[model samples]
Target: MQIDLAMLFLTELQVGSERLYKIKRKGTSLNLRYEIDGEIHRRSYLSGLSWRAILLFALTEGKAVTVHEMDQPGRYRKLFPNTLLRRLHWYARPNANFPPVARFYDPNGKAVMLLTRSRVCGHAVDALHNLAHSGPVFQPLWISDIMALRPMLGLDLVRDETFSAAMPISAYLEAAAMMGRIVEEPEFPGLSLTGNPRRLVTPPSSKAGRSIFDQASRENPALEKLRDRTIYADYSLTI
Candidate 1:
């Protein structure tokens, strides 16, 4: 289904009261545009990495971001590997289950599971499949779970935030600059909040790219374990 996941439209008086930058999802692709001195520039991305891109962009603008959902469904156990990348959904309320439940999207973009409160609060696992195959039933997980596993997944959780008003021009451009680095990093497969476990071949290191992970490394020691593992015949981590 088509959704307006998030949009950032920056406007400032110094910029002639015009929108300096704008970003949002249409159908499945991301649409980006920016104007400077009345010259508008536009671009689009077909990557499902839309959610993460929006988060980075928002953070760059110093704007708060958040997860939003439209309607409830019959089940929250089935995994929608690509859902989290499509939209930011903090909690899932299955059918009429009074309490809204936390969820986990596939780091490799394969599934989304409804986590039980127990699973949500448990210590993070070593790999995606470890958590996915925890039990017969698919348990949901909280954002904390996702954050804990950020290292294993190659994700940066710093950009996630509650929604805010449109950004100012200066901030929008600064955010755009950060987005450029993320987009240009050859080793990074588009910024995925769930991480990119499928990254079997670690591209040559880029100092700029590694800088992004520096913050994460300082925050958690688990990230220093840069060893790789094979799961279901697929490489789960970059060496």
Candidate 2:
């Protein structure tokens, strides 16, 4: 929820996350934290997808969804080891249960699991893993955003403009295999929603590259309306 000096006093716990943070007010901003390791971790209740909290509200009221990730950790790199650098990953759910059962990767790409069935919503975990792990899924639009990040990470194996949008990862993988290692480390995808997100952009500032999902956020309309809102926190952005 948006807060400002003129807003009335309110207190609440946020939803759609692994942890429930008691929402706190600071000056004109709404912030929350307690027993956390550091001050860098800042979270928004309905932050991930604009309507995520809405969806969660539905789930709490008996709306059934296969996604437990509504509360899954926001950052992917943090969950993996350091050796796993740039990743070109995807999952197809072909069955009515698994809509697109397709397995694919690049010659140089080391397969990584974006969807963790073990973590799928408590009730759906067994069903998701029923097809030998074919229940994992992410949206196609997210793939497009990851493709857009290729240029920034120096994974210029193939220009996105040079390939059909449907098959952009082929170039990304071909490039990574052919020596696309501009970054030795990964950045948190959470920065896209954090107050400090400029590094995720390209040019001389390439160190902040592994943010595979930032590209999709660029086209978000809800974020577009925040032009007049100012972010006051300095977020470190990790799970």
Candidate 3:
């Protein structure tokens, strides 16, 4: 059977909640790890397409389904009925009240997933971070704004991007800038920074790259200020 590779990876996950995964690079290998059923599972990839397919699968399936039980090789197609797929597609459309599934790289150049929620309620970032060894990043401004407006509308929200259009360019810039800063630092202790360092690295000149300097300037105006801080203070160098 022709398998949609994207659907296969995601359905293999142990957990069902919509969460992000981090892909690390070790020399020529891509190291992937995420929490499934509260246990950590790791795999290695040699191709970018393979890694992307894994992530796509996770987002599409949102739960684990064994291959033997599936009719199609692709987990996503097997798990999602036609009706659910249509609903997911409709909700995922640009204007729907769903969080867009976005990919980004950390300073160390690892591939990461950014997920948005439908409701304004608080999410468990620590849980997500623990699953991937990289902490989850929250877009609080967007979440807060959505929470404020949710009471006024009678919409059954599944994600908060419904009002993303109402957000200004500045808001997006600020969110991008914050992500840049967070990706540089090694906040999680379980994950190792040493490896091939290129297999899962971020783009050299993206929003995360720009935030390196911007964050440094704001946190440490003078280079002298960082002297007493932790070695990981400068996110650009460590990640």
Which candidate number would show the highest lDDT if scored against the true structure? 3
Better of 1 and 3 by lDDT: 3
lDDT of each: 0.26, 0.21, 0.27
**Residue 165 in model 2: lDDT:** 24
Residues 62-151 of candidate 2: C-alpha lDDT, one tens digit per residue: 554432121224222222212222111122111112121222222244322122111112211110001112212121112111221222
Q: Candidates' TM-scores?
A: 0.22, 0.18, 0.21
* lDDT, model 3, position 166: 35
**Ten contiguous residues with the weakest lDDT in model 3:** 121-130
The order by descending lDDT is: 3, 1, 2
Please list the residue runs of candidate 3 whose C-alpha ends up more than 4 Å from where it truly belongs after superposition: 1-74, 98-130, 137-239
What lDDT, from 0 to 1, does candidate 2 have? 0.21
TM-score of candidate 3 to 2 decimals: 0.21
**What is the descending TM-score order?**
1, 3, 2
Off-target runs (Cα >4 Å) in candidate 1 are 1-44, 48-50, 66-112, 116-211, 215-239
Better candidate number, 2 or 3, judged by lDDT: 3
Candidate that beats the other on TM-score, 1 or 3, i.e. the better one: 1
lDDT of 1 at 167: 23
